[model samples]
Target: MDFTPPQKRKAEESIVPMINVVFLLLIFFLMTSQITPPEPFEVTLPVSETLGDAESELTLHLSKDGDVQFEDFTGETAWMRLGGRIDPQTVVKLRVDAALPAPKLAQVMQRLSPTGAASVEIVAVQK
Candidate 1:
C-alpha cells in the first residue's frame, strides 16, 4: 500500500511574461497610432458641404476676434511668419472661427492674396 503525500506543485507561473506582453502591445499601439496635437487656440469651424481630405503641413488659424495664429506664432507675428513659409505652390489650410464675420474673412482672403498662396482651403465641418 502506498501512503505518500503528493509532491508540492510549483508556485504559480510568473506574471512577468504577461506583463511584458501587455507592455509590448501598449507600445505597439502607441507607435502605430496617429496622434494629432491639440490646436494652439480654440476655434469653432463653419459647416459646409465640401468633402475632401487635405493634409497640409501649414495651417492658418483665425479667431472670432480676428486674431491670427500660424503654427506657434500669433497675431501680426503670425502673418509675418506665414509670409516666409508661403510660396506660389504652398497650400494653406485656413481654420477660421465660425463666429467671425464675412467681411473679416474677405479681408483675410484679400491679405492672403499678396502672400502668393497657391491654394487656400477653408477648414470646416461637414453638415
Candidate 2:
C-alpha cells in the first residue's frame, strides 16, 4: 500500500455570512414590526401641550360617541374589568376621542373615581 496519507478535503464552508444575513433579516423585521396593539376603534385624539406616549399597562379607550372599551371588554364589562385591574396606586391611561362631549367625559371620570385609580393620564397628541 502507498505510504502517503490520503489527501485532505477542503475545509468546511464558513457559516458566518449565513449568520449575518439571518441577523440582518431579524433586525429588518423588528424595525418594521408594530409594537403596540391595534386600536379597538378609530379615534381622533385631542391636542395638548403636554403630549407624551401612552405606556400605561391598563388602557381605557373612549370613542366619539361615548363608547367605552378596555381591551376586549365593552360597556359594563369594560368598567368592571378596569375596576378590577385598578389598585390604590395604579394610574389608568385614558384615550378619549377629540369629539367626545364634556358631559360624557365627566360621566366616565365619575365612574372611574370609584375604581380606586390613584390618577388618570389622558393621552393626547402634540400640537
lDDT of each: 0.90, 0.92
lDDT of 2 by residue, 44-108 (tens): 99999876666678999999999999999999999988888999989899999999999999999
TM-score of each: 0.85, 0.76
- Native-referenced Cα lDDT, model 2: 0.92
- The stretch of ten residues in a row with the least summed lDDT in candidate 2 is 48-57
Which 10 residues in a row give candidate 1 its minimum summed lDDT? 49-58
Candidate 1 wrong stretches, greater than 4 Å: 1-7
RMSD (CA, angstroms), candidate 1: 2.4
What is the overall TM-score of model 1 with all chains considered together?
0.85
